[model samples]
Target: MAMGVHGRRGRGGRRAPMAEINVTPLVDVMLVLLIIFMVTAPLLATGVPVDLPQSRAAPLDQQAKPTQVSLDAQGRIFIDDAPVAEAALPQRLADLAAAPAPPEGRRVYLRADRSLDYGRVMRVMGELNRAGLNHVALVSTGEDQP
Candidate 1:
């Protein structure tokens, strides 16, 4: 060991040890990553466009994976990718509602094309409602959040 300023041995003649951990740079990097995620999270949720019919009712809070019924532009009805005849809708929904469920009740989501007739949509809703399926939902491309 070499002599230091005060004639005392000085850490094998090396420099003094680091007394504090440098965490400010790490915190800055983490904050930058957090800001990046906060900015991009909302943009990642883009969806298809549709002019949704509006009402004053609050959206339903559901806990189950709701059944999705889609009506195409040509007034064709689909229940989870299988084309469903209009005549068979009542029995189909009844069967689904009556089947064993996991949770959040026997709720259904109905997606009608924007070009479809309101009465047609209403009829589907009515049929499901009348079949004792009280938790039917009209699924649409919600309003653009600008």
Candidate 2:
């Protein structure tokens, strides 16, 4: 009498190694990374906390990394999230302008708290202009954005 096990081996009675790659694990890993980044992306936008004003204007198209100048509700000034004295702001802006710039010039994003005095914000803008950093964009939240 002869007996054979069903679906366990080929005609040669030997198991064949799988040649196909299993992509389920790879897909699972990629999905996990995507979720992690999606959750963390907004938090990384800016280090300083400010109650930005709302505007109906659309967001600007950004081609390069621009310098960030922020003014908080307390009237504190920050350059790229680092605190800067008002007296030193002009010098710092001058130094930034002296650095290598793109053909369109170094772009600066000015973020001021909505509660700040208009004159204070203008003073910072004046400093930026005096330092030859003319390409300034006011950063504001969209009307529908939180």
Candidate 3:
């Protein structure tokens, strides 16, 4: 019975500090951050607010960042979320076209409020075509999405 001063162990001394890392708390924090980002990511995608029409068409595959052109319910125009006067839109579009484009050419995304008249959307499209920005895609929400 070679008992130490504590009377429970042969080596009887202060226990060595644990070297293994506890990962439970780390995992918990990471999962919380991931969920927070997932919740806010969609909100940050576009700045200009518009009531998009719902469509059953599938989303397009994107290779590069496309230029966004948004038309609000009030018939205001915006390029990449920046407000542009209707008279200035053509010049802005032309400048965008003049910029070096990818091999597939520059792409434009048209996001118009569903409340807008069809002619308004077509006129915007027509302006884009005149500016040599023919690679235009109409932006819409999925039918199942809110």
- Candidate 3 per-residue C-alpha lDDT over 12-79 given as tens digits, one digit per residue, 9 for 90 to 100: 56566666999999999999999999999988887666445777787788788899999999999999
Instruction: Estimate every model's Cα lDDT from 0 to 1.
Output: 0.80, 0.90, 0.89
lDDT of 2 by residue, 85-107 (tens): 99999999999999999876789
TM-score of 2: 0.60
- What 10-residue stretch in candidate 1 is worst by lDDT? 48-57
For residue 56, give model 3's deviation from the true position in Å.
3.0
Candidate closer to the true structure by lDDT (higher is better), 1 or 2? 2
Model 1 over residues 23-50: C-alpha lDDT tens digits? 9999999999999999988887666453
For model 3, the stretches where C-alpha displacement exceeds 4 angstroms are 1-52, 144-146
Clashing pairs in 3: none
TM-score on alpha carbons, each prediction: 0.55, 0.60, 0.60
Per-candidate count of clashing residue pairs (backbone under 3 Å): 0, 0, 0
How does residue 119 of candidate 1 score in lDDT? 93
- Identify the superior model by lDDT, candidate 1 or candidate 3: 3
Candidates sorted on TM-score, descending: 3, 2, 1
Worst 10-residue lDDT window, candidate 2: 46-55
Residue 144 in model 2: shift from native, Å?
Answer: 5.1
